[model samples]
Target chain A: MTIVDPIIFNAFLNESKEAVESLEADLVKLESDLENKNLINSVFRSLHTIKGNASFLDLDNITTVAHEAETLLDEVRSGKRKINQTSIDLVYSVVDVLQEMLEDPEMAQAIKSVNVLKVEESKIEHIVSLVHELELLRYSMEKLPAQLEGERGDISEGLFNLELATSKASRITSELGAIVFGARLVPVNNVFRRFPRIVRELAKKLDKKIELKVLNGSAKLDKSIVEAIADPMTHLIRNAVDHGVESPENRQAKGKKQQGTITLNSFVDGNLVVIEIKDDGKGMDPDLILYQAAEKGIIFRGKENTMSDSEKLGLIFAPGFSTAEQVTDISGRGVGMDVVKSNINKLKGMVQIESTLGIGTTIQLRFPFSVVVASCLYVYIDEVCYAIPLSQMEESIHIAKGELFTQSPQRLKSGEEAMAVYSLQELLTGKFQIKQGIKELPAVRVRRKDGRLIALIVDEFSIMEEAVIHSVDSYISSIPGIQGGVIRRDGLVSIALSIDSLLETTFKKIPLAYAVNKERKHPEITDLQKLIEDAREITDGVLDFKLS
Target chain B: MRIYRRELFIFDIGGVPLALRMEDVEYILPASEITSVPKTAQFVLGLAAVRGKIMSVIDGGLRLRIQRQGTSYFVVCHVRGNTTAVLINRPLEAKNLSVKKIESSDVERILARHKLNPKMFSAAWEILKKKDSHWSETGRKFLEINTDQFVSDQMASKIIVG
Candidate 1:
C-alpha cells in the first residue's frame, strides 16, 4: 500500500469518526423501532461509506470491521436476517470496535498486549458468548411470573421506568450534540493522566527525587481545549522538573525533604476552568530573574527595584529570556515559557505566575469553560463587528450623553464609585474619535481581576448572540486585544476582544489625569464646561502625538 | 544545504521588482476586501479570510516605503511562521536563477542611495544568470526580503512612527 499523506489521513479520520457517531445514534434508535426504514437506510449508508473510505486508505482493520457490520445490516435490510436483540447487540459491539480503531489508527495499542488478528477473533468470540448469555437472560425473564408478589415491586416498576427513560433521553441528547456540533466536555484527566510516568522518567534522568500529585482530575473542559492544552501542560511539567526542582542533595542540605513535590490541580471557577501547576522546590528567585532579564535586554536594567516579585517572575515568559547560566538538554534554551504562554493565549486563556523566594512557584492557567461556543455581545466599532465575550462583561448600559458627571477622564457614576469610561474606538485605535450630537452611547462595563470597573463606549450595540468562536492564527491573535476570531453565519469575520488584554495594554495607560479627575469633582456648570474643554485639548494632543 | 539555483516568486510593489522564495508563496488570489485592524501598524491592511483561515494582509508598498499603484492580486505567503497576504500590483512569474550572496557592507552604498535599509532584507542576492537585460541595464540588484524582520511589530512601529 502507498503511504498516505498525513493531512488526508487526518481529514478522513475526522469524517469517519463523525459518520460512526451518527451511525451509533441511528443504530440505537433503530433498536427501538426496528421496522423504521429510514433509520436502517441511514445506518447502511453510513456503514457503506465508512467501509469504502477505510478501504481507500488501506486501513484494513477498519475496513474489515465496517464491512462485516455492513454485511449484517445488509442482511437485515434484505429480510434475510430478522432484526433482533442479538443482531443489535452485535452491531453495537462492532460500532465500539470501529470507534476504537478510529481513535487509535494502525492498531498501535488499542487492544493492549495482543496482536490485531488475535484481538479481533477474541472480540468476536466474546461478543458471541455475551449474546448467548443475553438470550439466556431473556429466556429466564420470560419464564417468570407476569405479576410480582410484592406491592413495592409494582411501584418500583414505574419509578424504574421513569429513571431509565430519563437516562436514555439524556444519553441520546448528548450523543446528538456530539454528532452535530463536535464539541464535548471532557475531563482534564485525559491530559493529566499522561504526566505521572513522564515526571518519573524525567526526574530519574535528572538525578532528582520528585513526586507529582494531580488533584481534581475530573475537572472538565472542552475537548478541543483539552487537546490543545496537552503540549503546554507537558512543557510546564518538564520545566518544573528541570528548572523548578533542585537536586535531592541540595534539598536535604536546605533542610527540606529529599523528594520534591509537583502538584497539578484543576478546578472550575464559575465560568472559568483553571489549572495550576505548583512545584515545591527551591522557589524562583525574583532578584535573580530580574538580573538575568536585564542582562539579556528583556527588561530595563535599572527598573528592577521598582517591580514586584510577581512582575519580576513574569519576565520568564519573555521570548528568548532564560535565567539559566548553562544550557541543558531538557530546557533553558529559552523557548518553553513563551511558547507555553502563547499557547495558553491561543486557547482564549491567561497565565498567571506567583512565586516565593524560598517556597515554591505556582503557574495558573485559566480558560473559559466552553471555548467552542460562547455567548457574546456583538458591537460595531468603525463599521466592523467585534464580539465581546459575555463572561467578561459585567453589564451593558446606555449612557445618556448629558448624564456625564465628569468629563476630564470620562467617568460614569454608578452608585458609590465612579467607573472610568473610555471610547472603545479610542481604546482600539489609540486615537480619540469625536462623535458629535449623539443622544445616548452604548457602553459595556467590565471588571478587572482586581475588581476595578472600566466601561467601554462603543459605536453601536447589536443583539447578544451565542457565537461560535474559533481561534485565529497566533500572528493575528498576538495583537494586544484580539483573543480570537468568529465568523458569522453570513460569512463576516468578527474579532473577539480579550478584555483582560485590552485593560492591560490600553486602559492601564490612560494617563495620570484619570486619578486627578477622579479625586476632584466639577459640580458647577462652568467648571464642568472648562473640564470638558481641557479634556478635548488633552485628547487632541494625545491623538496628534499618536497619529504623527 | 547548497543548491545551484533558487526558485523565486517575483512580484512588483511600486514598479520596483522584488522576489521571495517560491516555497514561501502559498498561493496568489485576486484582491479581495480586506478589513482594517485598529491599533496596528498602518502597513497592516488588516485581516482577511482566505479559504476559511484568518490571514493578516500586509500592504507591501507601505511596508517597503514605496508608492504602489493599483493592486491586482494578494500573494498569500508564510511570513514569520504565520500566513500573511501581501498586496502587490501583479505577480510576474516563478523563475529559477543562480544567485550569489552579496555582503551587506558591499551593498550599503547602493542601498543607502535608494533609501533602503539593509536589515529589512535577509541577504542581497546578485543574480548571476540574469535572463532579462532590463534589471542589469538599470543596475537593480535582487534582494530577498527577511519576512521575520520586515513584518515584525517593532520594525513596523519604527518605520511608521518615525
Candidate 2:
C-alpha cells in the first residue's frame, strides 16, 4: 500500500468534505424530483471527484464507499435502475456514512470490516464504458475547435483585422480582469445551499412535514456579511422548525396543510439586501412574548403594558427570553433568538419581526448589499474628515450656533418636525470646550431607522462620493460613535460614523421630560402603545387559562 | 556548533537612542499624512496609510514619558499580527551584536533608572554615542525594546472616552 503524503491527504480531506456537502444538497433536490437527470448527473460528478481523489491518495476505505455510491447514481442516470424514494434514502445514508468517515478516522477503520466488496463486480465494465464515452466526447470537442478555425479561414482575409482584434481583445481581457478582481458580490446561495438539508433533518426529527422554498437564492451580497449571518440564519431556521411549526396532526385539525411551508426569499432593495424567512405555522403571539420577557426578568414588570404590539413582539429578542414551554434538545435551551439579534447588530444590520396570530410570521433581516462600498457624505469636524453613510443622511443645513444654544435641549426645526441637535465633535471627542470665534455651525441632518431625525453639528461639509469602508481594528471598533474606518480617494483613513449607534448613545443622555414630551408630541405612537397593552392583557388571560 | 548573532536596528525617539531587533522592523519611511482617531490613547498618534495598508502610528516619546519632538520618520514594525509604526526622529544603520553578551542585570538597571516596566526592555547596551555628525566616547546606555510587549500593553490598556 502506498502511504499518502500528509499534506496531500489533508488537502484531499478538505476537498472531499466540501464535495460531500454539495452532494447532500444535490440529493435533497433529487429527493423532491426523482427524474431530475441534471441533479443526478451533478451528484454523480461530485462523488466521482471525491472517489478519484481518494483513490489517488490511496485511501481504500473512502474510495470503495464513494465508488459504490457513484455507480448507483450512474445506474439511475442511465435508466438501468429506476429512481425512487428508496433510492434517495439509500444515497442519503451513503452521504451520512461518508461524512462520518471523514470526521472520524476511527469510524473509517471500523467501516473497513463491513464487507462493501460484495456489492458488485459487474459494475467495473460499466465504469470502463462510461470512461470511454467521456474520452470520445473530449476528442470531438477538441476537433470542433480545429473545425471552427477552418471555417474562420474563409472569412479571415476580407473581414478580420487580426492585429486590431488582438489588441482590442487584450485590452478587454485586462479590463475584465480588473472588474472581476474588484467585484465583491457573492451569491447568497453559498449560504442558502446548506439549509435544505438542515430543514429536512429538523423536520424529520420533529415528526413534522416541512416544505422549504428558497427564492432569489442567487441574489448577491458581500461575502463577509453572508458568512457573518450564516449562524444567525441557522438559529432562526432551527427556531422556526422547532417552535413555530406544529405537528402534522395539529395542523390537520387547524384546517391548514399538513406540510408546513417555509419560504426563504432575498431581493435587492435599493442599497440593501433584504432576506425574509416566512413560515406558514402557528404565528407568534406578541403578548406571549411580552409575558415571557417579564417572566425571564428581561423587562420590568408592567413595562409590557406600555409597549406597542410590535415592541412587545420585539421582546422575543431579549436575552434569556424563550416562549418554549418545555426544554428540548432541539431548541428550547432559551439562547437562540437573542443571539441572532446581537449577531445581526454586529454586522450593522437590522432584524424586524411581523406576525399575525393564527396566520403566519415573517422575520426580515436587511443588510447593506456591500459593506465595503458605501456612498457617504463627508463632513469635517475639528479638522478631521468623517464619512456618514448617505443612506442615513436626510439633509444638510446650516444653523446658527446661538440658535442651537437658545433652546434648553437644543432642538432644530426641519419643516414641522423638531429634531434634537448635538455637536458631533463634542459627542465623539468628549471635549466640550466653548468656541470663541464660531458663529454658524454646519449640521448634517440624519434619520435613524426608527424615523427619528437628528442634526449633527460639524465644521463643514464636503462632496458626497462612494468610498470603500475598511473595518477598524477590534479595539477601535469597540468605541462608540465610530463604525469602521474608510479609505478616501486621497488615501486617508477617515472614520465611518455609525449614525444609529451615535444617535442611540446621544439619546440615552437626554433628560426624562424631554423624551416624554417628544413621545407625547407623537400621540399616535402613544395610542398604539395603549392599544397593544390592552390587547396583551386580554391575550395574557387567555394564554393563562389555556396553560392551566 | 554555529554561534548566532542578532541584528539590531537602532533609532532615536525623543532624543534618546533605542535598539530593536532588525527582523521586527519592516521598513523605515518618511512621515506621511496621518488621520487622527478619536477616543484612543494620547500616545496613539493616529492611522497612516503605508503601501495601501493602514497602520496605527504611536508616539514613542509620549509612551515612554520623554519630551515630545516632531517626528521626521516612521519605523514600521509588525508585532503579534498587528502592524504599527513608531514615530522616530531618525533610524541608524543596522548592527550585528552577540546576543549572549547582553546581561540581564544591565537591562534591569536601565529599567529601574527610567522607571519603566522591566518587561519593556529585553537587553541593554552601553556604547559610545554619536551626536552632531561626530562620534564621541560619551558612554550612553541604550535599551532594546520588546516591540510585542509594548504593543500588547498599549492595546490592553486602551481607554475609550464616552
Candidate 3:
C-alpha cells in the first residue's frame, strides 16, 4: 500500500523494524532455553509478529514462510514436540530469511520467484500444515510451570535488518532513537543499596559518621542519554562521597548529629533534567581559589586579597585553576570540577557551584529534558546559514561606531581588532572558499559567559530550523568565515557559522593585553603612556583630568 | 525557462571606487555610523551600523590603489563570506556592459605612440594610434598613443639618443 504521510509511515516502519530486530536476538537466546517451554512462547510471539508485518506490507512470499514458523512455535508451546538444537537452528534460519526478504531487494525477489503463489491463501495454507506436525509432537513432551516474562529487547539496539530497508537507509537511522521507550518506572533498590557502603567508608576515614540519601531511583531516562551521563554522574557522586560527607568524631565535637548528611536528588522539570549534589561537610573556601588564581598569574597578585566571593568562585574554571594542594586517590587535583563543567557544556548543559565556607556546598548541573529537539540561533556567513543552540549562547548586543572602544588597549575587550561591528558580507569572504569579490558586511555582537564578547560578521541571515546537520566533505576546505555548509529547504547549500571558530579568530585579533596608543588617545591614555614613554611633557598634557 | 547570470558590479568603498564581480558582493545597505577598531590595516576603518545591523567598513580605493573623493560615500562587498563596506573617493555609476573577455582573453597587440603602464590602467590615459594592419587615420592615431608598448618604446629610444 502507498503511504502518503511520511510521519505515520516512518513510525510504522520504525516500530515493525524494532520488532523484527528483537525477534532475531530472542531467537539466538532461545538455543539455551530450549528445554524451558516458556522460552518457546516468545519464539511464537516473534514469528507471529513477522507474519503480521509481512501481510501489512503485502509481501505474500515472506508472510508464507513466517506463518509456517509461527505454526511450529505454536505447536512447541503446546508441548507436542521436544525442544531441540536442530529445531532452533531451522527456526533461526527462517527468521533470518524473513528478515532478508524485508530488508534486501534481491532476496525478496528470490523468495517470490521460488514460491509459485505469493498471496494470503498460499501463506495461510503453509502455516496450517506446519502447525499440524508441531501439535502432534507437543503432546508427547513433559509438563512445565508458567510465569510472567520481562520485556525482552531494548529499542536502542540496532542488530538485525528486520525493520527499515528503504532506499534511503541513512535517512532512517537515528542516534537518539529508542525502540520501546520506557513509559513507567520499575522499582529497583539501587539508591538504598549504595548509601550504607558510602556512609560506612567515609566515616572511617574522616572520623565522622555520614548519612547518604539518594532520591528518585525510580525515575527513568532514555537509555542513550542516561548511558552518556552515567560516568560523569558517577564522578559527581564520588566527589560527594570523598568531599561532601564528613567523618563521625568531628560531628560530635561540633555538637551536631554524629552523622553528617550528603544528598543526591535527581528529578525532572519540564524539558530539563537536573542532578544536584549537596553536602554538609567542610564547605569550600573561596580564599583558596582566589589565592591559587593569583599564584598562577590568572589574576593580579593583590587582587585575590580583595576579590569578591563570586569572582573567586568564577576562577574555579580557569586553567591551572586548582587550589587543592595534595594529590589523592579521590578528586584532590582540583581539575575535577573544571572537567565536569566542560563535559556538561558539551551536552549543552550548565554547571554551577554554590558554597558557604564552614556551612555547606552544592554543585548543580542542568540538562535539557530531551536534547533531540534543540533551540538554536540561526545565523549566516558566506551565504550559508547555521544553527547555534541557544543553550550555548550568552547574549547579543550592538556597539555603535566609535562608541566601541578598546577595553585595555589596541583591541576592544570583545577581542576583535577590527571594530566589533561587521556585516554579514565581510565575514563570508574570510571563509576563503567562495573566491568571490567583496560584498556587504553584517556583524552581530555575541557575549560569552567568560565576560568575553565577539562580533560575528557574515554575509546573510536566516532563522530557519535545520532538521539534519551534514558536514561538507574535506575535498572542500572549510571557509574561514563560514563554519561549514549544509543543505537548506530549497536544495541550495548554505554556509553555517562555526561559533567557536569565529570566537577563536576574534580573540586572536584582539587580545586584551594589547593597548592602542594613537597619537591622540583621548588626552588621558596618551598622557598616561607619555608619563611612561617620555616624562617631561606629561605635566602640561594633563588638563584637569576628571576626579569624578 | 529563463536563466540569469550574475553580472559584475563596482561600488564606492568609503569614497574610493573599485570594480568587483556582482556574485562576490551579497547586498548593499546605507552607511550611517562606523565604529573604529584598532590594530587593523590602513584601509580598514572599523565596524559600522548599516540598516539595523552592524558592518565592517573598508577603504576600497586605498586597498586597490584607486582614487577616492569623499569619506561619506561607501560601497559594501563580500569576499569569502566576510562582508566589508569599502570606502571610496566617489561613487561610480554602475555599467552593465557586455565585455568580450574576462581579463584573460582580451589582450590585443596594435601599433601605438605612447606606452603607458597597463598595471596603472585605473588612471586615465590618452590614445595616439590604431592598428595599421587594418586601420583608419583616427583609429591609427588613437591606438599609437594608447598602446603601452608604443609609449615605453619611445621613452627607451629617447634615453638612448640622449
Which of the CAPRI classes, incorrect, acceptable, medium or high, describes model 2? acceptable
User: Which scores better on DockQ, 1 or 2?
Assistant: 2
lDDT of 2 at A447: 71
Rank the models by TM-score, top first: 1, 2, 3
Best by lDDT: 1
In order, what are the TM-scores of chain A for the candidates?
0.41, 0.53, 0.34
Candidate 2: tens digits of C-alpha lDDT, residues A1-548: 35554555566665787788789888877888877889999999999998998789776888999999889988888889998988888888888888887878653443343321111233345345545655654554544444446664443442334433333333333323223322555567777777888999999999999988886675556666776778999988888898888889999999999999888987544334678899988998888888878877888997776899999999888888888888888887888788899999888788999998877889999775323445789988877999987765777877542233223334434344556666687678864332334545577777765786677768779979755555455456556766666666555678888776666677665411112112223322333233323434552232111000
Quality of model 3 by C-alpha lDDT: 0.46
Q: Name the best candidate (by DockQ).
A: 2
Compose the digit string of candidate 2's lDDT tens values, residues B1-162. Answer: 122356888887666668888888898877777889888878778777655555678877777766656657888896555567888788866778543323578666656666766566676665544469654444555777877654556575542211
Model 3 stretches astray by more than 4 angstroms: A1-206, A218-220, A302-308, A371-548, B1-162
User: Which residue pairs overlap in candidate 1's backbone?
Assistant: none
Instruction: Report per-candidate DockQ.
Output: 0.09, 0.24, 0.01
Q: Would you estimate the TM-scores of all the predictions?
A: 0.49, 0.49, 0.29
Please state what fraction of the native interface contacts candidate 2 reproduces. Answer: 0.38
Could you tell me how far off, in angstroms, the CA of residue A284 lies in candidate 3 after the best superposition? 1.4
Question: Model 3, range B70-114, lDDT digits (tens) per residue?
Answer: 445555665334444655444343434233222222222211112
Candidate lDDT scores, in order, read 0.69, 0.69, 0.46
